[model samples]
Target: KFEQANGGTILLDEISEMDQGLQAKLLRVLQEQQVERVGGRKIINLDVRILATTNRKLEEYVAENKFREDLYYRLNVFPLQWLPLRERIADIVPLAQRLLAKYSRKMNRTAVSMSDEAQRVLQAHPWPGNVRELDNIIQRSLILQQGALIGPGDLHIQPGSMHTAEMAGRINSVGVSQADNSQLGNDMKQHEFQLIVDTLRETGGSRKDAADKLGISPRTLRYKLAKMREAGIDLDAELKG
Candidate 1:
């Protein structure tokens, strides 16, 4: 398959989570530009460009012997670090607008725009989950929005209670009622839990399908469900329905 991708790019996302044996195999492939398939003797040449991404610090993994040092060096030839959304405040509105357009089209919803108040709320967000979180929020907001404009009320941005003091001040400046913000924060988790349950139902209890519809990985969905179970949420009963 790597050989078939000759003259193209192959992205290995979350490379740090890959198995150590697989890392050694990949290192060999990179060094030799060829791969031997399982149960096959012929070596197939590959001329594919490899791009890998990981949120973890590879150097730390190397120190812990969880990641191969040679593989890390090979993948780090041209490293690019993207700042979290909270730090790139200037990009928030533009990214939000782009995402809104994208997901609206995807969901067959009206081409909607964000209200000034909603934009302010987004800019004030701590964005602990970064771009992916923002994307999910936008998609959810689109589903909840009734009009052509998405208001702050439509957003289900979770972990809202963890907002910075500056963000709280900004929310206040936007004339968002404290009661409303507090209620939203309180309802956020239940809303997310319900969303997951509904997606699972829609996908007939298939975790992979539900994750695909929710724009998240099955591993992420499993981890979230595990946390919910740890918190005493009755997932088994909810999922059975």
Candidate 2:
């Protein structure tokens, strides 16, 4: 009965992780101001306002059976999706400067500024991990930096930064080879020649039986034997009646 008497708000962070059973239970509490604890007889009265936040797309997860549909709709009443850092390049330099100042104060250091080249590097690099990754990189650069200004060398980011997924895509996009492909054709021919020799051996050098086992006419089998002989593959000796 806290919200009933005194106005207050409850924040549910990482709300996508909430279970279906809990979501159902929470739905009841949201619609009705009655709280029935687990295995409790009396329904405790409470007035609570919820503000749920999640980094994941709860609607997609709900569609995929990973999240509860009812709960997703309930919390998505007024949702605001923040844009990634890459989409807002203008803010990067200002953000970096603010971060630099914050780190400088925290570390009891001063005059730790980004050089022009370092600013260019930061602006070009695609921050996949977004603000968190940028914060970490700045922290690392601040720790490594000895001089007053931090250059691209201090940041340690190349001109065109590559993410793990991009690298993996490049690796997986490779096609089949021509040398091995050509060798495969030769291997198939050799396998067929070996099959004829083995089938003849199993049939005690009987061409008629060998032809039947190979699912080929006796005429075709005779032609194949001639080819094997020409290729220096001793089919009769290999067959060994």
- Model 1 lDDT tens row, 1-241: 6866888999899999999889999999999999888899998888898889998999999999999999999889999998888999999999999988886675556658999999999999888777877776776765434479888767745445422222212211222111233333333333455666666766789999877655557897898787556555666677675
Superposition error at 36 for model 2 (Å): 11
The lDDT of model 2 is 0.66
Each candidate: what lDDT? 0.72, 0.66
Runs in model 1 deviating more than 4 A are: 37-42, 158-241
Residue 144 of model 1 has an lDDT of 39
Worst 10 residues of 1 by lDDT: 168-177
Which candidate's TM-score is highest? 1
> TM-score of predicted model 1?
0.65
Which of the numbered candidates is closest to the native, going by highest lDDT? 1
| Decoy 2 TM-score against native | 0.51
